[model samples]
Structures are given as C-alpha cells and as structure tokens.
Target: MSSASSARSGLRGRTVVVPLIPCPRCQATVRYYVSNTEDHEGWVFYRCPNHSATGCDFWFWEMEYVAYLVDAHFLVGNQAVDAVGATEERREELIRASYERRRIATQVATSRAALARPGSLQQNMSKHQESALIGLGAEILVLLKLLLGSVMLLCALCVLLLMKK
Candidate 1:
C-alpha cells in the first residue's frame, strides 16, 4: 500500500502498552519512542534506557508487534468463520465477503457514533478492525506528561551543569 494510505492503518495509531519490562542486555528500563517526522510519525517502538550511554542496540517496533498480534486474532476469527460448511472456492468467497461486510459495518458504526454525539473528530483506534470515537485520551495524557517531564529534566540538568562552572 502507499505510505499515505497506510499512515495510520491498523494498530499504527494506538499507544504501545508501555511494559515496565527491562532491557536484558543492560538491565536498564526500556522506553517507547516515536518518530516525529516522516512516514514513521506516531509509530512507537521500545528501546533501552542505557541506549545513549552504552550505545545499546535494544529496540522494537510496536507496529510490527501489534500487527502480529492482530494477525493471530484474525486467523482465529477466520477459523471460526470457516467452520461453516462450504466448498474450498465457496469458503474463499465467503472470507472475502466477510471482509467487505466488516468494512461496511465499521463505516456504519462510525457514522452512528458521530451522530450520537454530534461534532468532534471521528477516531477508531483499534480492531476487523475499525469503529469510532473522538480520541485515545488516556494515551494522549501519558504522552503529554512524558514530554513535559523531559523538558523539566533537561532544564534541571542544564542548571546543575552551570552551577558546577
């Protein structure tokens, strides 16, 4: 797919569940990072806290992980759908039809949600595989706090260094 078309496709928009999982190599806390510019904007990944200090190579794309998880779930759902009796060709047709139905249903659901509230940006952050809402508020809050904390920490370090001079 084209880059623009898939910009926020699938699980690309959801916040990565920040696990307090530590880096195996340095035993440092791992953290999530997102690209601010380019096609990778909003794409989240994990890396070691000691990356800057130790040049730690620890990193993972949350997008890839989420895609895998979704694929697994999709497979299971397909199996359930395929349980109904049909010839191989018919089964394939059914799968395609199911996808179309899901797309239509999602659009309908999103429109309904929009009408229910009246006025706001429509957002569907997850799942065959979309619906609607305004935004992922909790995730946004966490991100904002992290940004603010970083700025504060940077200011403190600068002040401390100037004092030592």
Candidate 2:
C-alpha cells in the first residue's frame, strides 16, 4: 500500500481523535498521550468505545503506524497524511530513519535534564517542618503557663505585705 497508509496501518479507531488518523480497524477516533520516553513524546492509540454494544476489540500504537508511514514515504503532518508518494520503499526508509534519529536526540536531552526521580523528598521536608511547628507551639503554651503562675505568686505576696502593713 502507500507509504503513509503503511505507516498508519495498525492504528484503528481511537477513543479520541488525537493523531487525526482514523483507526484503520474500526474507523474510530484515536487518542494520544505523553510517551514515557525521556522527552515525554506524544504517543497515540486507538480503542473501540464502550458505547459500542459489541465493543469490538481494537487497539494499536499510533506510534508504530506513523513510523511505518515515514518508512514508506508518507508524511503525516498537520492532521493529514501525505499518502501520495509512499510507494518508494527506499525513500520511506530514509525519512523514517531521519525521524528516528531526531527522536533519539530529543530523548537524550530529556533524560539528561531530568536530574531527580520524583518522590518523598517534599513529603519528608513537610513532615520535618510540621514537627518543628508543633514543638514551637508546645513551647509557647508552656511559657504562657509559667508567666501566669509567676503573676499569681506576685499578687499573693503583694496581698500579704498589705495585710502586714
């Protein structure tokens, strides 16, 4: 088939129209999300909606299909596949390779920039701060009680002196 069609081959209807390419299997919407790859690239997929009574089993990565189309001389851009000249396998191969190279470069940069693994650091810090605050609060309460006691003692001594006078 044409190069672009070959690239987008496996993608069939999606739950959402993400790649703009209809799923070849069910002619449904295709959904896309951030890829786990270093750069969090966009990845697309297709699945029949539960709304469908039969709920035909259809799912595939829009990623692979796009790669294939690029390999086959089809350019998917601006929500349209240039399916005109994907017949030349060699040219398609070159295009796909070029795209792959760029993808790898982006992944490398993303990996490098992501220095820290996300988790407990913030939570731990919050816990420590909270503990410190609780301790400070308790100290304030203790100081208040001590001050009140001293004031009462001073008042009692003053009354005794006045009685002696």
Candidate 3:
C-alpha cells in the first residue's frame, strides 16, 4: 500500500492492541525500538522490518500509538471495544485526551533533556541520585497513565448507566 493510503487507514481492517500493532504498509508485526539518534535519544517507537530494504516508511512513536488505539476505540483485544464506545462525542473526547498525553510527554522529555545536560544542576548529583530521579519520573508517568485510564473507564460507565436509564 502507498504511504498516503495507509496513513488514512488508521488501523482499519486490522486488529490492534498495545505492543502488537501490524505495520499498515508491509503487513508485518512491528517491534518496539529505542531511538539512539541524537535528536530523540531514549524515545521509543515502532518500525517496520521492511523499512530498510523495501522502503516501507511505517514508523510511529510508541506512546502516541498507544494513546491513539486506547483513546479512539481501536483496541479490540480483551473486550476493549465494549468499554470504549465509538460515537461522535466519544471521538472528540478521545482526540483531546490523546493530544493532552502527547503534550505532557513532550514536556517531560524537555525537562529530562534539560536536567541531563552538562554543567546543569543534575551534573552535580551522583550517578545513583540521577538514576533514582529518572526512575522516579518513569514511575510517576505510569501512575499518571493509570489515573487517566481509570477516569476514562468511569466516564464510559457513566455513559452506559445513563443510556440504561
């Protein structure tokens, strides 16, 4: 499939779940990879295996892809579709939620880069201290995701209850 056509597909005609999405271009299962490039060190993403040889350019940020599937009712495994409704209003809410997540992730990445720079405040800290701080940041990010997921569940339940009444 052409890149533009696949770009418009958005997980259509395929089963999707976290960490197991198929590449829209080559139909191959994508694997998570850490970016080693100077521009986006430590960032994770999915890349098609055919990208190097066959010129398939299917690449997506890991966190953003998860947010997209979870928010947009695209996650079909584990009975997720029933939990997340596919409606106009729900679609709008999902867009907002996804955007907020991306924004927060960008902020965290910026903050981390600033702290890790040479001669910065973090440079004065011991290696253990710096590692601990990074660990803490990751833990906080997980906690935030849990909180957001819970809130989304509660909202879905409320909508269902109202419909039943």
Candidate 4:
C-alpha cells in the first residue's frame, strides 16, 4: 500500500474516525473524535487530522449538520470557534442602528421646534415692534376723529352767524 493509503488505514482504527464527507480545506478525509459521550447526549467535532503537516486546520461541530450553529444562536461570548464573524458584525450593526435612531430623533425634534414657533429673541422683538406699530396707528385714528368733529362744529357756528346778517 502507498504511504497515503497506509496513513488512511491507520487513522480508521484509532479513537477518531474519518467522516464520510471530505475536509473543506484539504479535500482530504475529515476525522471525527467524540470528545464527550453520555447515555443521553453526545458531542463530536470534525477536523483535518493531518493539520500539522498540511496546515489545513478546518473544524466544525457535529451538531452543525442539521443547521449552521453560529447562525442559529447569537452566542457572542464564544470567540474561540466562531467562524464567518457573524456575531461581531451583527453587534456592530445593532450599535450603528441605535446611534442612527437617536440622531434622527434629535433632528426631528429640532426641526419640529424650529417649525412650530419663533425661537430667537430677535424674532420676538420684531413681533412686539409690529404690535406696537399697530397700537400707534389706532391712537392716530382716534385723534383724527376728534379733530374732524371740532372742525364741523366751528363751520356750523359760522353759518348761523352769517344767516343773522
């Protein structure tokens, strides 16, 4: 048997067994070692056994066969074995979204207040000045009415004197 074939057979009898599926990194046979086994539950991991020589250290959980474990759970604490960086990326996205929401809220509040009423002291002064001008115009109209009434009375007296002549 060739050296590679001999190595394959030697790996079969050991505690670790070669998986039916091939390794993703090396395309060689992936080896599975059952790290924990109880009567009710068991956990296994698959990796390239020739990782030291081939530098192909791809590993995956046995439970991941049903579904990708990292995607199903948001387990952020387990940094050792998480691939794809999904959890970290999700955390960053959430934080950015929160900040964006706050920023939008602030902008909305500012815009609403700006639109609702005059905020500046200068605008308030202008409004007051307009009201004062309207009041002065009203006073001028009252004085003009009194002056016209006096002029009409004086003209009537003059006509009565002229009739006596």
Best model number under TM-score = 4
Q: Against the hidden true structure, what lDDT does model 4 obtain?
A: 0.53
- List the candidate 1 regions with Cα displacement exceeding 4 Å: 1-18, 65-165
RMSD of 4: 18.0
Candidate 3 per-residue C-alpha lDDT over 43-153 given as tens digits, one digit per residue, 9 for 90 to 100: 556678788889898776655655555665555556344223322233455457667777999999998988878667555667768899999999999999999999999
For candidate 3, the TM-score is 0.34
Compare candidates 1 and 3 on TM-score and give the better one. 3
lDDT of each: 0.52, 0.51, 0.62, 0.53
Summarize candidate 1's per-residue lDDT along 58-160 as a digit string, tens digits. Answer: 7766544334334445223443233222223333554576677678989999888776773343432243124223246667888999999999999999999
Q: Which residue window of length 10 is worst by lDDT in model 1?
A: 1-10
Q: Per-residue lDDT of 1-165 in model 2, one digit per residue for the tens?
A: 122222233322321112334545566543433344632234334344432655665554454544543554444453334322332333455457668978998899887556344544666678789999999999999999999999999999999999999
Q: How many residue pairs clash per model? A: 0, 10, 0, 0
Assess the local accuracy of residue 20 in candidate 4 as a C-alpha lDDT between 0 and 100: 33
For residues 1-165, could you state the per-residue lDDT of candidate 4 as single tens digits? 123321121212332112234565667866655544332123345566777787786766544421233344422233213333433343455557667767998999997777667655566778999999999999999999999999999999999999999
By descending lDDT, how would the candidates be arranged?
Answer: 3, 4, 1, 2
TM-score of each: 0.30, 0.32, 0.34, 0.40
Q: What is the C-alpha RMSD of each candidate to the true structure, in Å?
A: 32.2, 12.6, 32.5, 18.0
Worst 10 residues of 4 by lDDT: 1-10
What lDDT does model 2 reach? 0.51
Q: How close is candidate 1 to the true structure, as a TM-score?
A: 0.30
Candidate achieving the largest lDDT: 3
